[model samples]
Target chain A: MKNNIISSIRLTIVMLILFSGAYTLIVWASSQLTTSHGNGDVIYFKGKKFYSNLGQKFTNDRYFNSRPSAVEYNAASSAGSNKGPSNPAYLASVQARIDTFIAHNPKIKKSEIPSDLVTASGSGLDPHISVTSALIQINRISKVRGISENALTTLISKQTEKPMAGLFGPERIHVLKLNIELDKMQ
Target chain B: MNTEIIGVILSFLVVVILAKPMGRYMGKIFSDEKTNLDFLFDPLDKLIYKLGNIDFKKEMNWKQHIVVMLTINLVWFVLAMLVLTNMGNLALNPDGNPSMSLDLALNTAISFIANTNLQHYSGETGISYLGQLVLMLFQFISAGCGIAMAVIVVNAMKEKVAHTLGNFYYLFVRSCTRILLPFSILVAILLVLNGSPMTFEGKDTITTLQDESVQVSRGPAAAFIAIKHLGTNGGGFFGANSSHPLENPNYFTNTLEIITQMLIPLAFIFAIGYMLKRKNLAWMIFGVMTVGFLLLALPTIWNEMNGNPLIEKMGINQHGNMEGKEVRFGAAASAYWSIATTVISTGSVNAMHDSFMPLSGLFQMLGMMVNAFYGGCGVGFLNFYIYIILTVFISGLMVGRTPEFLGKKIEAKEMQIAMGVTLLHPLLILTGTAFASYAYTQNPIELSAWLNNPSFHGFSEMLYEFTSSSANNGSGFEGLGDNTPFWNIASGIVMLLARFIPIIGPVAIAGSLASKKYIPESAGTLKTDTITFGLMIFIVIVIVAALSFFPALSLGPIAEYLSM
Candidate 1:
């Protein structure tokens, strides 16, 4: 038993050094070759920095809004609302988001507000919104910014990321990138 | 078909196509047959064996295997505790995360070591990069340990009778070096190139396009996530797990994560066939697991894709239940992932299970409750072996003949151990939930903190926590405030017992069987590889899981479903 314990301890140490040390170091070294340099994909636009993959809150009406976040797009601590589908309080919050979306875009009907606009994503920091989610917010952004609705729509189409292989999953727009492009529009 | 459905089908297809070759590769590794990759891994494994003072060729009996497994696990637990509790003082404190409380540390350590990765705390804010690295280490070794123990059982199951099984250290080390490490490095590189972070740089305080400054938590997440899925140790580098955008960037990485997580559990099923030279037997087992998986998976996909009815009544026209799910992966893929992870005991989530339709939650819980349909790495087969034993014994009694498996007579001792192992799952889960429910009722006002949702759904939350822990599946309802002393300690104990007992029971049974005189098959003998026997095993699994968990299911997800 004593001999096994000693071997066990020795094995654990050796494994720790191999996996926790050598394995991770290999990954870290390989990551240095990527464009992000392992710090995450950062975009520099107009002297401001943003993580391209992480969602950010856009309270201003001039920019296309992101999905409702449980933590208000807090990247430091991500979470979902974790509310059950039938919870009254959660339903009420979704209703509240719908009402707020309708109020912001008076021209848009309540039925037109996509559910993604109201629901909080699992990560809270979801960077992309559904293509429809982005489309519904266009009226508000266009009305606020005085950019022609056509121009704004064109800009969104430009920022749209096609579904993987153009055949699987949803076609979505990266909200951060869309908003950045919106900023660039004359 | 819609792209969402296509995505789901694509993920499964990829897994099916890849699992066979990977299984054969694993077969060669465990049998010490030369593979092309051996050139790379042999030297590393030799160094590990040499440094550990292990005799790679020295065989051990089942008791010795268990002892060494437990001893090494003990060492890991202690090391994990030290690193987790003192995270603030750890070398890679880029985020300046505080050290864990003793109870939380205890739970975290056991959760990872048991291959149950059930997190009572969120990843980004709870532990440091050093801490994540240590936990990642446990992820690889714990899974390696599981595969090795399973291989020992495979060794015992061989046609020839043997006193000593293959050496545990050799199998364990080879599993890590040959199987897990190579795949992890490959997947980690894929993740890094595809936008998941792999760095020691802490939180990058980036200014958003809107001018709000927020701390974006980054780490060596690509490395962590690679092994996280590859090992079926679904503990995330971030609290949001694969659901986080950076942790699982886009649809490509999401698909990769799903594929990698399901890969080993599926491959292990095939490897058993290769090792035992019972390809038919493996195929039969695969059929049963696939049928069981589809029964749970199809409904979850339908539930999520149908969208929540209550929300529809509120004037929303969403394609599916998007609540607490990502837009890129959509409902079908997320629902597929939830069931896949649960059935395999991966327990990683691409979507928040708490926000799933109540019936989907039930299926997810059922996946773990059954706990044998393509379960975690090596242990999945071990769980299924218990079911196989029960089936053999019960069917034997019906036929008025002694039960036999692989020509070894099934005796009372093995049956007792199998029954004990089978019952321990429900016993641990129910007793733990019942105790928590009782405590919650006693001080409803004070203990209200335990649940985020109200009434029946809240009951489901507590029930899910214990179920996930007891199953060693590790995915939780998340709404449960489980970091409290009551949860941390209760579920920690559950995880420990649930993990070791099931493993020990199967190994012991295999050991006893290996030592017995071989009984050649006869006209009256029941063939485990036959369709009839497969059906019997499936029925036994359903009956056991259903009978044990039906009452608990009714109280939690079923009640929630009826009310909705």
Candidate 2:
């Protein structure tokens, strides 16, 4: 009985500590909303200490996203490419981007290609891929995560974005969403 | 382009044909197979009941019923929160699909429960198929329940009704199976045919034009896409969102999505009129809703097509007004779709809403804040009924008679229910948005350089997104790069309030509406059949929504519009 009492006391103390800690976090969080929002600086890359800026953060290892960035998509310079898809120049520019991605991710072949990787999405700041686009990158991310390539490829079938109605559109995968999963250690 | 328009028109016509048969089917099922519709859907109903473990023999008093309903939803919220927080360890595949943090978990739980699918995390990257299914599936059911209840309330009001307003369990099943299921399935298949890959294969390895290693993303996208649009759940898997081909593959698909997104809410009003034996009254309601949608859509498309001056300066092609939208759909469809989706509470977008010009953004926001025509399915009839009652009261007061709706008296008790139903949305939006905006500003350390706009336009876009998301209208302003703790939680709360308060309010109203003595239809009743009353109802909704959101509007999008 005495031992049981002691364990209960310990449990209560731990609960108190946890509850207090959570309360403090919410309070601190509420306090943070006072000034401004969406100034991209808030995002922290998983396990990376430094915050990544929208511009000038290109790396060879990471799959590049953000279509036709304008002034690095700075809010102060918020605007679009203003180039319609049919614009030959825009097509040429996007084609150049496709070539660049191919140059970086060498294993990906031209024949087994996802258009989203080569063509700039309309948002230009797209953070997703059509399931096909993500599928195109499955082999590379599988290697990175040290998982079997075949197994990871199977996961894509599970992850693709479905059309709004069975008859309306195509399935897609948010690139950021899919990549985050690809980067998972387990 | 014209062909696409015609295709969209045909798709809409098809949806219109489907709506009432579906609505009647919905009504019949609520009567629990005593009616023909329920009998048709009995097998599916039993399947859902068996899976959900509903006990029809168990009769619940109103209080216990509310308690169970509220408790179950809150518990689902807690479970959703747990799934999100542990998504890294529990659901994350490899390397690091961005895990749902405590904040995101909270946000997602609230968003789903509230029927607001405002995602703080990008799809594909932020969530797994498991997470989306577990969290967003609830949204599908919650939305169906809210809509089913609206139809149930209308049926309960029929003086000649033989049954208690339909069972919630049966309604949920029938709505999901008969109405939501077919549409979602049809749409998903269409999306797959349009080139959205429906696969379990992880990102594929393929050599690019220049050989480089890349991780391709993949999944069963067709399953969720259709419902996301039809159910008015606007959560997107990718950050580029609905505009991405996977979410919205082509122009034909986009037009179909746009029409279907608005079809149910518009048709529900007619279902309501039929249930009340007032076909002309339904037409009057349609006139107001149609006019409202056009007013919002016209200005938004106009501004978007005019093209942004800053982009024009770069000497880019402005032929079809290129901005943040898919090329296949072009600017016109994207803009038009944005208006319809946001206006009707189906917030699937093919363009970056924040990137829209000032007046355009305003109209869209106004559609959400005031212009919820019938709103979500079950919720719409409840909201409109409040306005209908309010109209009866004020007009009756002026003419010196007790206000009667379908022969029922509008007393303080009924007024209170309507008033609560009406005020609930604005209050939640105002309070949650204000709290969120204030909290977001305090955390300067989190803001990235690209997101650090000094103007209210920037601030207002963020504010508008919070309001919209929390209110469960998934349309967002493209200007705000929302992927942070402040937004994740704040928007989460907004989604919660947007979804539940309206539901709770209407459920309370429906319960009350059900219990009231049925007043038979009389010859001397005030004519709700006229456009005047319909406009009056629309105007009151506008006034209440506008008054609530005005101060916040001034601080956010309005200031941005002015600067532009």
State what share of the real interface contacts each candidate retains.
0.88, 0.07
Candidate 1 lDDT score at position B144: 97
lDDT of 1 by residue, A87-126 (tens): 9999999999888888888888878777888899999988
- Model 2: residue B371 alpha-carbon error in angstroms: 5.0
- Model 2 clashes, total count: 121
lDDT of 2 by residue, B1-564 (tens): 343344444545676677666555554445444554455556755654554556544543334334545655655666577667776666535435656777767877777666667766666577765565565466566667667556556665666523355455545556666677656656665565554544434444322212333334445555566667777776665555566655555556666677667666876776666566677877887777777777777677666667654434333334334445554554556667777777667676787665566566777788777635656666655666667778888878877776876666667887786687677767767776666566656765655432434456556566667558745777666446666676776666657656665556655655665566766656667777787778777777677777877887777667755654
Taking the candidates in order, what DockQ does each have?
0.86, 0.05
Model 1 chain B: worst 10 consecutive residues (lDDT sum)? B201-210
**B1-564, model 1: which lDDT tens digit per residue?**
788889889999999999999999999988779999877888888888889998889889999999989999999999999999998986889778999999999999999999999999988889988999999999999999999999999899988788899999999999999999999999999999989998888777877777888988888899999998988889988999999988898889988999999899899989999988999999999999999999999999999999999999998777789889998789999999999999988899989999999999999999999999999989999999999999999999988988999999998899899989998999999999999999999999999889999989999999999999988989989999988998999999999999999999999999999999988888988888988999999999989988999999999899988988
- For candidate 1, give the lDDT: 0.91
lDDT for A54 in candidate 2 is: 19
Candidate 1's TM-score reads 0.99
List clash counts for every candidate, in order.
Answer: 0, 121
